[model samples]
Target chain A: MILQVAKSFILESIRNTGVFLGNLLPAFIFIICSWICTISIKSSPETLDFMIKGQFFPISIMLLVFAFAFSSATIYLADLKANNTIHLLKRTNISPAKYFLGIGLGVFLMMNFVLLLLLAGYSFIISLSISALISIILICNFVLLAIYPLCFIVAGIVKNGKVAQSLLVPIMLVFMFSITMTSLFLTINEQQPQDYYIYLIWNPMLYLSDTLQFQLNLNDHTWLPLYQYSIILTILCMVLSIFAKQIYIRQD
Target chain B: MLILDKVQKSYQNHSVLNGISSTFQYGHCYLLLGDNGAGKSTLLKCIAGDEKVDHGSIRGNEHEDVSNLVALQYQFFESYSFLKVKEVIQLFTKLIANPSNIKDLYELLDIAQYEKTLIKNTSGGQRKALSLYLAFLMSKPIVLLDEPFADLDLKKKKQLFGFLQNQVHLQNKCLIIISHEIKGLESLFDFVYIMQDGQFIEHGTTEELVEKYKNPTFSGLEAVYFEVTGQLLGGRIK
Candidate 1:
């Protein structure tokens, strides 16, 4: 039954091709802008690598946070509004755990598919090796998996697709604000002698960025181990999955 | 058989179902008829386990889930907004493992050519037919259809009702229908239940209720409903 639901959801996502393209358009525009702005610049290979490598993680974070939010918000939250498909699923014998896991995994996989396109574009522009890019993507998926269950929580709180759409912009705004503040703090601590970035200990996005940099073998602006933040995210994801299942039942 | 004892449900402070006690037997067609705001739909939702009862219990055969016995076709199911008609049908057939003559059911419902069409693009009547056809294929012991006749043309309506009546008689399933469309459908019901302001005011064989309330100048469910609820019947249920 879980597979059936997941298949149906995937099929539905395919049928709504317009939405898929709309969500993807942002990545295309960002890539086009980057290429256009860099076309006239003359730089040595060292300078180019330094520029791209330094910008890679932060740019990826911005694009990913936006892409994941827009795509998953439209895919799951809109479909979930009014407990639309759920009424049909609840009649089946599938357990709640299997049902949610199937849906979560389905959305995770599809979002990665979209993210891969963006990754390929960036990888090509930065001239990064395929192996290095794949590693970054695999680790980025851990962060993506961690955020989607929380989106389900938001879906449960909203009443319909319209509300979900409206709430999505503001939710993305919150992420943007959080990312900006963390970046500012990181910059401050690096330029100053005293390190006050410890205040960002609770910022999930900061941890995600640091984890990405650590995986890339670059120094994370904060000096946490890669495993530490991933462990924290994994625990948070499991807890959120449990809560999402409970809220899904209530919505049903 | 299915049974509900003191089924009480409320939304916030407003009680939608106040102490509804009833028993539904197998191989019978039950009609739940009521005016607007009469709680007929709420009672059906509770019985089908789609809505939780704040203070009541619903019991089916021993150790059986309510969903095992009853399947619900809600008035406005929103899932159709995304799936294709064929995908929807495939899910039902695959999950329930029920053998179905897909070609015949599709032809009978006049949806054979549109199987590949997206459900979101289907007309209202087509969606209704598809849902009813899928529900028929599942073939649960008890099927609950809330306002099944709302969006069909006359020909499709006749085909659907005839199919429903035949399914009940052939399978000996306990089929429950709740609708305000009470005119001329009294003959299709073995038992009819009436709700007035969240309470069951009257319930019995349709023949008995109509006979008891029938007058020299008036008869049928429309008049019976008028006598019971003190509101003239609207023409929409026809």
Candidate 2:
């Protein structure tokens, strides 16, 4: 039953014309930006790396947050409003734990699939090496997993898809501005060791972009260990999952 | 068999069901007559486990769980997606594990063509019929229908009443139907329960109640409803 529910949700998300367009449009924008970045630079290898490095973190955060919110939060809330199955399931033999697990698993798989496709396109165009590609994938996976549970959290609070999408707007905007500002600062100086940047240590996006940079030997970070971020992300995801269950109970 | 003991329910501070106790046996149809706020739907929801009782025990047969217990067709049945009629029937068929043929259900509702139509595009009467079809297909021993005849035309209403009569008389599913028009249903139901101010005051077999009250003017269901519930037939009982 869990697998059946999860598969149905995934299929529904993929088939929703709006969600599909939302996913495609962003990745298309990313492609356009990357192309523009490459064409406009016309500089040496170090200069190009420095320029790309500065922009990557902010752009990745914007896209990741968008992808996660649309595929995870918006679609889930729509299913809640439009489907009697959610209410029926609540009143059935299926436990709330199992039902939410199905939803979470579905969202995780979809976000991961979309992330891989986006990253694969970026790697193919940039001629990224094996290490850089692997590093980027790892970083993307971390942020995706960490932030994915939040969709359920938002879905639990929001009554419908449109409201859920609206609720995410402010949060996404703030994260986007912060990430962009951080990236702008990081790109300007090659001599400034990344360890001196105090703000990057606290940001999930920075962890991902920096992990990739370190993998490519493009930058260094001595401020914090990667395991610390992983631990924090894991704890946050679990708490969000538990909170989502409570919301389900309250809503029912 | 079904049993309720001291069941109470409230919304915010307004009490809907207050210490109500009733027992229903198999092979009987009961008309749950009440005024509009008399908590007919709330009682049904509590019975179906769709709403939790404030302070009481709803004990049923040991074998009955969420799926096999009472099946409810709410006043406004909302479908998750625009499912084809056949798909909805097939789903409850699987869930119930013992359902009549889809064609038979469709034909009985006088809506065989609707089987191919998306539920979203169907008319109100068609949707109501489909909701009835799904509930009947579930075939749970206990069926609670809230205004099943609403939105139905006169002909469709007669057809539904026919189908319901067959289910109660032949299949022996315990039914609690809430409707204001109790004239024709006097012969159809074995028992009549009247509700007023979230309480059941009088309940007995239709014959027993009518025979006990000798006056023809006062013996009919509308008379008993007005006498017990203290309101006109169409007045809100809440």
* B74-130: candidate 2 lDDT, tens digit per residue: 666556344566665654454344565545557867766778776667877777777
Which candidate wins on lDDT? 1
What are the runs in model 1 whose C-alpha is more than 4 Å off?
Answer: A1-3, A43-57, A69-75, A81-83, A192-198, A201-204, A211-222, A249-252, B62-67, B97-105, B182-184, B215-219, B235-238
User: TM-scores of all models?
Assistant: 0.87, 0.78
Model 2, residue B34: distance off in Å is: 2.3
Local accuracy of candidate 1 as per-residue lDDT tens digits, B27-109: 89998877778898888778777788999788887746676667777666457467878888877676565534545557767
For all candidates in order, the CA lDDT equals: 0.69, 0.67
Report the first chain's TM-score for all candidates.
0.80, 0.80
Q: Per-residue lDDT tens digits of candidate 2, residues A26-93?
A: 64576667667778777676666655545553365347646764445555655565545565444344
Which ten contiguous residues of candidate 2 chain A have the minimum total lDDT? A83-92
Question: For model 1, what is the C-alpha lDDT against the true structure?
Answer: 0.69
Name the TM-score of chain A in model 1. Answer: 0.80
**Chain A TM-score for predicted structure 2:** 0.80
